[model samples]
Target chain A: MSSGLAQPRIRIPRSARAGEAIEIRTLMEHPMESGIRGANHAAVPRNMLSRMVVRMNGETIFAADLRNGTAANPYHVFFVRLQRSAEFEFVWTDEAGRSVRATARVAVS
Target chain B: MTTASRRALLLALVALPAAARADAALEAAMREAVGPAEPEEGGMALRLPALAENGAQVPLTVTVDSPMTAEQHVVSIHLFATRNPTPGVASFHLSPALARAEVQTRIRLAEDQQVVALAVLSDGRVLRATAETRVAVGGCLG
Candidate 1:
């Protein structure tokens, strides 16, 4: 089944103090079909993002395992302490093995 | 092996786990993820609106009292909607790099239910909190 999800959107402040905690927000567009029968009586074939991983300069900072109960267009906001200028990578993977990734750069002053 | 048989095998393997997971209750999943330790009540807090006009996008926040230093930090936070069709809302893994034990997100609450937040610390201590919210409009079915 085609997931029909657009690229994920991630927002991180461009820079932060070396020891400051910063908030990172992300959102992805997805149908999150629950595999339950619809009004037409056809199974929707559950297709939800099963996993999400965030890494900063190759080190995993956050990760999550999602389930079918998650709503469409999963949105998340979390905090991370900035220590150095690095590339932040976000990866989302669905049950079908399809994955979407986004990256942002943060400079620690 | 024939292409069709290989495809069948792959489907079987995938479906097996999915079915097994479906069979496991939400409590079982939480126990499996957090292990047998009983979570304490004070270190974590779960925030949810007392009354939700709509269940589609209810703002939720989870915060834990922790130094978040290298020696002591929260390792993960797991959210659960007690009465939703699926018990597991989301599980978040954290690192010392976060320097704080807090997360904010939007969630869908199927109905009036209690939202639970469970946090695991670096010292293997588990803490939890719960908040009840009344949803007038359904999010899952609607």
Candidate 2:
């Protein structure tokens, strides 16, 4: 909870047509250790970013439950249809109860 | 027990011997994702590179054929790497706000294996799809 999971990045188009689905991508840096092997050969004890939530304006649009098999540095791409300009909020929470938040705004025409 | 020690116990428990996976494990994972719902093999497409040389970070996509309106939309999408030490990969929950039933991410596979995707629709239908990838090197361990 003290340190790790460096800068997270999110990508979204600056503008989109009303009623059209727009793409959204997010990446968070973490080891996502599976804890499946023994001794030094194994991953260093099951440190994973366990959850992700994406919200439009204030309503949640997408969420994901991550696990050991989700690979190091979680990445996800999803879509949302816009009827008007809105702000998006993304939150990533790890198993140790640490969390990070980011936001982006999209202009809809 | 302290959370740290409990997690350490979990880590100790997962020190496993990766073995050949069985179909039942995949089915169990599917069942765990959605209680008592049998997934039908249609309405979803799982995209994975046919030959993924790097199993650590294989680009993957799962798209379900749904209008994604409030009347009828995907409730969630579950992914499984059947051959990994842990078969359950991830689960994505969707709402009409998403407007489309599609998602993309990266997954880790233990070996040449079949990956499955299950789409749980708002109308109580579970649609499924599977793809096979040949993994040259596993990323589970050094």
Candidate 3:
């Protein structure tokens, strides 16, 4: 359950038309160890990002509950309708309580 | 018990829990996500490669047909891997703020099996879909 190196990455268009749906993708660095790996479970224990939240200007637009089945370096792609310029925050948290956050801004003209 | 018989029994036991537990876990996940409402098939699209070269990361996309309005929209989506050590893949929660009821992510596949998805609508309806994927190499065992 070591998340010491957790890093969050996000991709979003810097600009978009008002009311247009924009794509947002996020990736976090983690082993996402399922704990079932290796011989007799002697290897890495279960460790994975359990929750992910995407908030736009303080209001959540999307969220995900991840499980051990989620692949390592968890990645997600989704769409959100932007009405104006907003600060988008993405946070990923693991079962160990370690969290990584990243922010991006989208301008709607 | 004879040695050969014991070995066969051990093998059988080893092979049973992964699938059996998966059934129970997946069933509970579905029940919890859908509540008392019975899931109605269709309206959800699950996209996965027919074959995946690497089981560690298989791309999956799920889309549900809905207006995504405040009055009516998809509430959440649940994914399950039929043959993994653990079946629950992930769940995506949606709101009207999202323009579409679609989510894309990557997951692990222990072996060649079917992937299931359930979409719970805001109005208490559950949509279900499944897709099969063949993995060249099994994951979850490092």
Tens digit of per-residue lDDT, candidate 3, span B1-142: 3488456656755888654555666667777767767678899899999999999999999999999999999999999887776678998889999989999999999899999999989898888899999999987765
For B39-75, candidate 1 gives per-residue lDDT tens digits of: 8889787999999888877888899999888899998
lDDT scores in order: 0.80, 0.85, 0.85
Candidate order by lDDT, decreasing, is 3, 2, 1
Structural similarity of chain A in candidate 3, as TM-score: 0.87
Q: Model 2: per-residue lDDT, tens digit, A39-91?
A: 34354666778899998899988999998679899999998999999999888
List where candidate 1 sits over 4 angstroms from the true fold: A1-4, A37-43, B1-24
**Under the 3 Å rule for N, CA and C atoms, how many clashes does model 3 have?**
0
- Pull out the clashing pairs in model 1: none
Q: Best by TM-score, which number?
A: 3
**DockQ score, prediction 1:** 0.36
DockQ of each two-chain model: 0.36, 0.53, 0.66
Give the alpha carbon lDDT tens digit for every residue of B1-142 in model 2.
3488456555645654233124445556778898787678888889999998898999999999998989999999999888777678999999998868989999998789989888889999889899999999886775
Q: State TM-scores per candidate.
A: 0.84, 0.87, 0.88
Off by over 4 Å in 2: A1-4, A38-43, B1-25
